[model samples]
Target: MARPSSDRLGYLLVAPTVLILLSITAFPLAYNLWNSLRHVVLTDPSSAGFAGLENYRALLGDPQFAQVLARTSLFTVVSVSVQMAVGLMVALVLHRRFRGRGLVRAAVLIPWAVPTVVAAISWKTMLDPQSGVLSFLFGVDTAWLAGEWTAWIAIAVADGWKTVPFVAIILLAGLQVIPGDIYEAARVDGSGAWHAFWKLTLPLLKPALMVALIFRTLSALLIFDVIFILTGGGPGDTTETLSYVTWREFLVESDFGGGGAVSVLMLVLSLVIAGAYTRLFRLDRREG
Candidate 1:
């Protein structure tokens, strides 16, 4: 009886928070799902009718949407991979005691603290062929955003510069929690630095690595502000991502059904990526 009462009390304590979360998240999601199934064109209000997955069918088979999806996937993979590698390197460097380590860490984190739009704008100016610092230094007047691959590279670099620091901070925290005794023991066993790091550090760092990967992957999937500010999906829509397509559908073209479907797809993609990471890393299971 006491256990049941305690559980009831626990539920009562959490009920308000649960309701609040549902009100904010569940309500909007339900609304979006509802809209995704109906043809609610802003221009053709009278033509609004039940779409019944028609919007999804059209968008899924859309060549333009297909291209955007591919670009978004590629961007996510490249951005997350680069961020993880660079972040791991930084974390390793910072894990060691050095002169002005605090200052160096803080300096590295400054970019992470900067606003996304501001960073995007700054990078755009730097990469601009006319009167841009990078172009001036290289002594070439080629437009970076005008090229297909160069445009993606520019966006990835800007995003990586702003985000790699966050990954490093997370990884650094993971590195700090590791016991020094273990490394000393490895050294006693004549284990080289590379052997210890490869055998011990990476295995222990899986949790943090998965976390950083998922977060950065999700951010890359929904990437819009940076691309919007830098390129605006220009150069023949080659730079447009799924999120960008959704915005164009809903806001630009006023295709409510199509936009809502794309938005739902994005939500699904995020969940899938997060779930895959969690499962791949077995984050829930305790290491023996």
Candidate 2:
């Protein structure tokens, strides 16, 4: 009886936190669903009308939405791939000790620590056409943000620059945890550095690589702040992503119903990506 009462008290203690989470996250989700089913205009509350699935249908048929989805997929894939590759290289290079290695590691982390908005703005300045260093050094007058493909590249570079450090840090932790004696034993067996890295390092680093890739991929999928600051989803909607579309719908167009549909789509995409990652990684193997 006393144990049951103690358990009840513990539940009571955690109840508030649970309620707060529901209030913040779950409530909005429920509200969005409800709003999506109705024709609700923020500027005109009188326009509230039950539209059922019309908002969803409208969004699905919107060509602009399709284009945005494609752009988002491309951005996620390209940016995450580049970030992972570069970050892995950085981690491997930093794995070995050398003079000023510690200082270099700290300096590389500066991009990660900087605010996203500031980084985007800084990159924008550096890529500016007339007075930009890149334009001057390359001897080309290219408008990065004014073009569709260029805008995506700009966004990717900005996103990668900020996130590569994080991936390197995660991989570095994984590398440090690897037993040094394993390398020594491999060397005794006449395994060269390249062979050891391929056979031993790669195998041991799978979990960390998966983790880094997932983190970077998910972050890239929902990229918005940098793009918004840099392009505002302009250049003829060339760089518009899902999040950008949703923002424009809710804030710019003031169509809560349409925005709700976009939000639902985003949620679905996130779940699908998460499911795919889980299946690909076979995390169940670890459980067994």
User: Which number leads on lDDT?
Assistant: 1
Cand. 2 TM to true fold? 0.94
Which tens-of-lDDT digit does each residue in 28-47 have in candidate 2? 99999898899988898898
C-alpha TM-score for every candidate: 0.94, 0.94
lDDT of 1 at 97: 99
In model 1, what is the error at residue 28, expressed in angstroms?
A: 0.7
In model 1, which residue pairs have backbone atoms overlapping below 3 Å? none
Model 1: residues >4 Å from true position, as ranges? 1-16, 283-288
Residue 198 lDDT, candidate 1, scale 0-100: 96
